[model samples]
Target: MKLLLDFFPIVLFFVAFKLWGIYVATGVAIAATVAQIAWLRYSTGKVEPMQWLSLGIIVVFGGATILAHDETFIKWKPTVLYWLMGGALAIGLLGFRKNLLKSVMGAQLELPETAWRAMTWSWVLFFAVMGVLNLWVAFHFDTATWVNFKLFGGLGLMAVFVIGQALYLGRYVKDGKEVPVEKP
Candidate 1:
């Protein structure tokens, strides 16, 4: 489904890494990301902003990894992307006084202003932490270990965080509708 499509590049990268090596894996990742974006655009008539951002990051870092014959660029790609996302959310909230999470999901889930603010900050924190975690693993571990972490650890952490977020948000909903609550 949509989830499989979203993870197509990462899965391909992992498989390529197992069969070949980091450089070939990087090439496969770059090509896979490009193909993924193209397929999305062709089928959906448009690609999401995040998807475009992913494509740009991969092309830049992956291209550097290939051309320079170094794995460091690819190693830093995830951290860079994560920090950029975290920075964007932080700036949007602090500078513009906007809650992007609320803006995006408000139509689907109604929650108090406080809840929205908390949710946004939670995501901001998650991204920041994830970025640091990526770097820690990338530098502390070997290439094979880093690659495994990139696919398994990264996705596992994301899944856990998402599940936690869902549980946290569950309290605000009842029977598919927002539960009414008093505001201070």
Candidate 2:
């Protein structure tokens, strides 16, 4: 349910793009993202940092795309978001005593420090790699192809990441307990 909610803006963006144009689609996406965030907050009384960051990126890049009359601005949106996340994770690993993944997922994941460290590092690296890949695809691919990749490819990568993470998490997760997520 939450996953579907998260994808609502992307779906809207795609539909709007098909109906109107890149700029209008981006604008609509930004609006949808904000509405979703507000709805989530009202219903749950909390929001994730990632969600807010994503919203910010959509608005910023979407506006840039509209203002500059170039899709390139929006194209780099993912790259910026992913790289920032990657850098934050990497920095957290280096600076903090406990792994960020462990802190967030420790409720269900009881893996050792080494495992947590590795997982955290993997996230950092993955996001960084995603950023680079987004840039490559945007700059090299055709406009339609880039849009498709931005929407479908990004979602595909996310699906793979979640599945992979579930596998890894299952290895050390306690027998039958749900993980606790921080919402702030």
Highest TM-score among the candidates is held by which one? 1
Candidate 2 per-residue lDDT, tens place, 43-113, comes to: 99999998999999998999999999999998888899899888877777887765777778877556667
lDDT of 1 by residue, 53-77 (tens): 9999999999999999999999999
Q: Write down the TM-score of every candidate.
A: 0.96, 0.88
Reference-based lDDT, each prediction: 0.92, 0.85
Top of the candidates by lDDT: 1
Question: Candidate 1 has what TM-score?
Answer: 0.96
Candidate 2 residue-pair clash tally = 0
Model 2 CA deviation exceeding 4 Å by range:
173-184
In angstroms, the error of model 2 at 91 is 0.8
